[model samples]
Target chain A: MQYTVISLQGLSTENCQLKTEKMELKEKLIASFMAFENLVDIDLPVHDVRSEAIKEFETQGFPSKRDEAWKYTSLNSILKHDYSVFPKRDNHIDYNDIKKYFIHDIDTYKIVFIDGKYSSHLSETTHDGIDVCLMSSALTKTKYRLIIENYFNKIATKDSLTSLNTAFSQEGAYIHIPKNKLVAKPIQIVHFSTGNEAALLVQPRNLIVVDENSHVQIIERHQSLTQNPVLTNSVTEIFANKRAIVDYYKIQNDNENASLIDSTFVNQKQESFASVHTFSFGGKLTRNNLNFYQNGERIDSTMKGITIIGNKQHVDHNTLVHHIEPNCESHQDYKGIYADSSTGVFNGKVLVDKDAQKTNAFQANNNILLSDKASINTKPQLEIFADDVKCSHGCTIGQLDESAMFYMQSRGIPEKEAKALLMFAFSNNVMNSVKIPEIKQRITKIIANKLGVNIGFDL
Target chain B: MLKINNLHASVEDKAILRGINLEVKAGEVHAIMGPNGSGKSTLASVIAGKEEYEMTDGEILLENENINEMAPEERAHKGIFLSFQYPIEIPGVSVTNFMKTAINETRKAKGLPDMPANEMLKMIREKSEMLEIDRKFLSRSLNEGFSGGEKKRNEIFQMAMLEPKLAILDETDSGLDIDALRIVANGVNKLRSKDNAVIVITHYQRLLDHIVPDFVHVLFEGRIVKSGGKELAHELEEKGYDWIKEEVNA
Candidate 1:
């Protein structure tokens, strides 16, 4: 199959001007590459990959509306800011001040980053049977060289944003689970932007490899400590070996001044199961590019997300599931609630290869618009080359069910609470599949908080 | 202890309830029997303060207080309940959670704290057992994929939990088998007391057989044409609604 790469200049003049401005930012990023490399080890083998990535990003500055893959989401406005590539100093954050961000109800391994640098005082890493440490260590240390050589940047797409992240990759979580070993506790990767700069841009790259017959669960979040403008361009590549099980959760509920571009790539081997759940509640702008590649038969790839936004918040979810082997299955369900002038986009594509016969792929995108100004653009695309495969896609955009509202109101629930309950129920299907009880509860609390309700229950 | 004085209501400029006058005393059961399009359900909805209906005239009094301007939930807090003919299916809320929210909201409106968990659980167990509902059914999503009988029974179960002053069962007997009908009627019978009243709106007398009503009113073309004792249901059953329609037209 052939993929077309549309030129950014083909767009309208307005978009072209925006892209031109972003091109300046891209030059600034290219000029700062030497400074970034000077901070890290220049002799490391990963530096070559970084150099190549920077060259690729230079060739493709930033994707614009002209690109077919970026038709619904535009990055020109966010890229206009002159973002500081690195913070001048390491900001200290007291654990007591930011404890509310963590799921304190349970014990788990945590990899914490403050202002794009690792915070040893706030992080808990393990070096026992499994490796749960920083990507910087994994890149420099000889003990982890084999894993790094085998899996670093292996499955991540070479898009301009991802390439940019690869060019600036220095500090993020790096986990390696050995064969036949199950990680007892879920790992939490949290990056907190202190907002010390006028406008800061942080690129965090994570590598996770779970070997055969092992299981691991990971929760990742990007939070902003202040109202200053902070943009995070993060990339995570996960590889699940044969018979491996991996559950990944992303919680994106930051302040209004914060924006994120998250690119996650998952490669699953034979009989492996990998599920990624993204809960996006608050942000000025969020674009999630989630891709799943099934490399072997009987693999299961599940992608689910719930987006609830109000005000002028904008969220875009662009997902792709590529089924290459026969008998593999993929399921995608996304639910969104847009209120006020908030806008949402869901572009879900499932591609079944010719040899992927007996592949069962189902995709569903449902959204509710609360205000007259709120809008959602949802498209589900299924490309099935195999005649015998079962591939179906469905998309719906609607308001809240009036009858359901009346039912709850008549039962003594107020209008606001009733609407909240209906919205909760609308997204409850995805929440039910969350494996960790504490994480599920935490997400439920965040949703309730977003809805501005103190319903005395867990919901 | 409910009274409707010259009640006239319409929906979208189309008149449905025309000058309805009725009274239900405490410790009494009133069965409002009518054929289709006779406005029986409209009267129930208007009495419960369904906002779609425009009460163009007359007053609805609950315990001698006018409730025409009250919201549905306000009326519910004031001891009014309307069992929907077709219960709405809420896909994600469990039956128990729905009931819990309903009960707590009502309590909070009355300036009372939420019911304690153990007490709430005990009440749920007792009421569900009264309706013969399985323990597993309480955890299922509210009314989603529920059998017709299960939906009706769940309605009565909620009525039992709320213990309202006046409960209106609108077409509750429809879509229910004889066993489910008997079970639901038995649950209602057990909850009936001198301090509360019930208004059963049905086309058939099967439900009245289990929960006997003191007065049976025949409503035709938005007006109550005839009112009698329990024997009126038997007469209406023996002779269909045609007699009542003919009498009203004459």
Candidate 2:
């Protein structure tokens, strides 16, 4: 009887309420659709895109904690708000202004993206060792489309965030360096968001492929031109073929009001090397997932990250380094500094598969809390399925050493200066991984400014 | 230059220094001799303001100024140096950087400007030679992987660089070969002057032969029960600490 009564009530009122909500959502979606239609020349079908997203959302239940990739970070906070998807912007972004964000050491081939769309007008080509192009143009080139279709979203899953990125995947960059070629210079990929449009969502996808015996360094940086609350969902995929060397860096320095969700997947072949460094400095809520797989013998992979969270910021880093072949090695180091009610979470896993004998893996996560209310949850796990492997993982969560602090204080460093010095030194382990001078200096300055200290390292 | 009046201290709940009294004027070298657990090291650490040890009842003065309330770094600025029995191992911090920080901090506390890097490097080189410390050691991490004798030599090198008015050598001669002892003693003797004093705390009399002390005090049960000239060290070495315990009780 109760079920019959509920069914009658549901049939009478559900259609009307559902129609009203749908209308509201459609109105907001139309505004964004019109904005993008006016801004970019690309023919991205907005109606089809929204219908596909709704279908996926109905099946996936909004990507909950049950999903392995999104376990540590929750999308519930974002889905709770009825947010309008942001439209693309056609505003002009000076390439010269964006060049300042590149790592200014060694020669570099740059691919610049303005307001979620590739800008070929701001890019240049060199005769040295590599080919760089915008992803949209690469799709039209026909020769690279097979490689793009094969590897795009191959390693990344249809988790809530990546699904969202894929659903709106419109613009980004593609970099390819051929075999036996040494680029000698780093490649800088700069993405800048502009315009006063509120509630904007930008999706930037990058695919970097280094052929056999090749070497390249790529730095991907994301910056915002305004303080509005924008949502950025980005995905990057990298392939390091046999004997190839790739050093990839991702820097997220967006406005404090923005939110970011980024995922990077790397695969290495025999004798290949892949090193990834991530620096998280901005965003109200940021989540980064980095996965590196060593699928061949003697391959080496290193993943390093440093995050500074202050003023009610929330940052989460989830990383995995998998050793699937014999004689492979992996090292991971991530550190965080939290102050002013900020929160940081790090969960790293180092897995050594069976038959991967003689594998060596090490992982460490260290955090220092400067304010009493700040908190950090760090977990470094090791799963060694082989008996002959040497694997160790450890995490440390503590305040600044009182003895070390007193030691510094006794040396006449004031209390505030002493604390800042220790905090800076703590992050030095990860900052030292930067190979470029100007980029390192800029990061150092940003860190100093965030901590309210003077510039001590020369850029 | 230094005065300790009835200094009593403890670690945790156990008392170590029991009503210790000592006075050292400029140009004097005093040797504190005792067996293990006799509180010789405790007295040195107490003077240097180590926080683990609590001062129960005591008064320490430098030039008639109360220094009992000062922190270790402040004590360092006031020209008090303690060569730790066991120097700490600090990784990733170079000896040069550590010494520069120490010296600069002391100088800043004394209302002095920071020293230029070049001049500081020069001073480090000179003092390292006097202490028989290799110049390359300054580039390495502070006391990291340092041998027993190397740590002692580094301590003396730091002392020579700081040029403190009152130097407390806490078992500086404990973990050294004959050669290292001679080098360390020579370093200390070279640094001695009329405007400063040195207090050498040791368990054995072998170190006193290299840098002879002007006076010797026998510390039994945390208090100095006997005092004599430098020959007192020879007597303590010959008869051992048991004889003094018997004599004091008798």
Candidate 3:
């Protein structure tokens, strides 16, 4: 197969050729490109954007080991053979298969994206205290277009994958909670990826705005209905205005063959509070990026993450906490329990800008390796431009405490039971941070199942 | 009843317990007193099945049955308890939960049913009261942030709850005020009976004033150099361990 390397100044894409003997994939990519051209106006201006994106894709070779962000996990195995980026819409998965991920009775606000396409049929349109709608539809409406155009793509890096997301940004969800108004129930957003013919790439964008003195909760669920190798590139941004409070949770429990690159961006204003809780249990390869920006005085942000990896899977969590104003505080605690021959990586950074005194920032990443083959590479960095700030970071990557394990085992607790008990205790430290009772319980059940412990929670 | 015949143990190839012999019958209290580095604690730990001690040559019999192959918990199920000099602090697990799990595990190993939570709570209440432990203290994490006196008292409380047939108190009287020592000794005395035996391991003879030992044995270089009635403890306390060194030399 012929290959072309596209380059545009500093940004570039590498050339690639089909390795598979199959001849049908060429027709699939051709058809997929044609479908994209048919959906959007192929005018001169739009053509330039598409050509630029494709050129970048060619030059970068679809982001591999050379890329700093994608160093730990290589997508070469994913694109090794002839995989179709765009396949005919399978539509074979029943709605019930994806409905199980939905959270019910959560403030009654629902936004559903089926097969990466926003579905109005499965969503609730009207809400008294919040505005929930699709970004694609909202962009067409003059009133909401201004907000979408101004904020979209502002918080993410200009990488090939993010650019591709914007290049094909067809459907997404936008939620705005008015000032002083509290959403009684948590907003539930579900992203479903379907099709088993080939590789499916789905990018779901979510934007949540909490005005001054407002309170809201957002629960995001990412799942792939098919057992095939699917790729999900998801980005979520949240804004907490002065004195506002926001609690965001992203639960990634997709198929084990699926890979995901999920990022959460949070901005906090004066006296505001923002927290993001992530529980990652599935996926063949997963990377999570959480960035918290404290922009006002007395603002606080916290990031909590728990990752349980087994088999030969790989999971990485990278976080950055920026203290831009004075008297801001941030804390990060991420724990991982790995078994089999899996690998886990955690890279956390905290930056205190100049004049941001009394910042009070702390970061800790701890890992428990259940098997000798399992390994973790954790790095916690702190950059302080201000001298009077209190900042500390620590990373620990080791096997389960043998002393503690022996202590438990000597009590007649079997080896497996003792290990599970210690793991449960290790995970509970982060799970307890979820203030919402139902959500906390649900997370506990997920951890219990992953650790092979029977806590007697009926699903 | 237990017997240790020519017990020899070492740590990292350094001989610590050499040719130590002792025996205890039911309803007998034997105090094994020794100077620092004389392996008094090693004897207690080896009996409790601590893995740090390498048994170079020894044979330990519990009711004439060899127990060298058994694990610590199995030995515990066979009625062996050791009051740690320094109890470990495990965070986020309440004392009640730790005790209940320990008790049920021992019971299960003995083919006994696990106690109900209510019954366990009642037992903990009674034991805490006997040890002067506050009700709220039982709800807190195990030994975390506990005072020295409280930790020692909690050890006694656990001893009361376990009701082992062979109890070994290793330095339980260390770092305690006169009042706290009196309270702890009183608890040990109250729990003593003919069905179970107590082994008080201490450097000082003050604890024996309360829980009197039937026989006091002075352990010198890992062997009992002198054995006598209650008067032996008083003599060691008054004349110091220098007298035992001279006697061994003679």
Q: State the lDDT of candidate 2 residue by residue for A33-134, as single tens digits.
A: 456545444443333543465345434544444466555454544433345455435667776676666665456777876667666676654434566777
- Assess the local accuracy of residue B10 in candidate 2 as a C-alpha lDDT between 0 and 100: 91
Q: List model 3 lDDT by residue over A1-459, tens digit each.
A: 111122444223222332232123333443465577677656534345555654554444356556676656555455544444544553434556655576642445678776777666767755455787776665456666566655655566556665555555556778888899877777778877665556676767777778899998888887877777777777777888999999888888777878888877888889999999888888888888888888899998989988888998888898899999999999899989888988887888899999899999988888888788787877777888998998878777667776565454444444555566667666666777887777777777777777666533221
Clashing residue pairs in candidate 2 are none
Q: After superposition, how far is residue A270 of candidate 1 from its true place, in Å?
A: 1.9
- Candidates' C-alpha lDDT: 0.91, 0.77, 0.77
Top model number, lDDT: 1
Candidate 2 chain B has its poorest 10 consecutive residues by lDDT at B88-97
lDDT, model 1, position A333: 92
Backbone clashes under 3 angstroms, per model? 0, 0, 9
Sorted on TM-score, best first, the list reads 1, 3, 2
Model 2 local distance difference test score = 0.77
Report how far residue B234 has shifted in candidate 1, in Å. 3.8
TM values, all candidates: 0.94, 0.81, 0.84
**Deviation (Å) of A162 in candidate 3:** 2.5
Question: A78 in model 3: Cα distance from truth in Å?
Answer: 4.4
For candidate 1, the share of real interface contacts preserved is 0.68
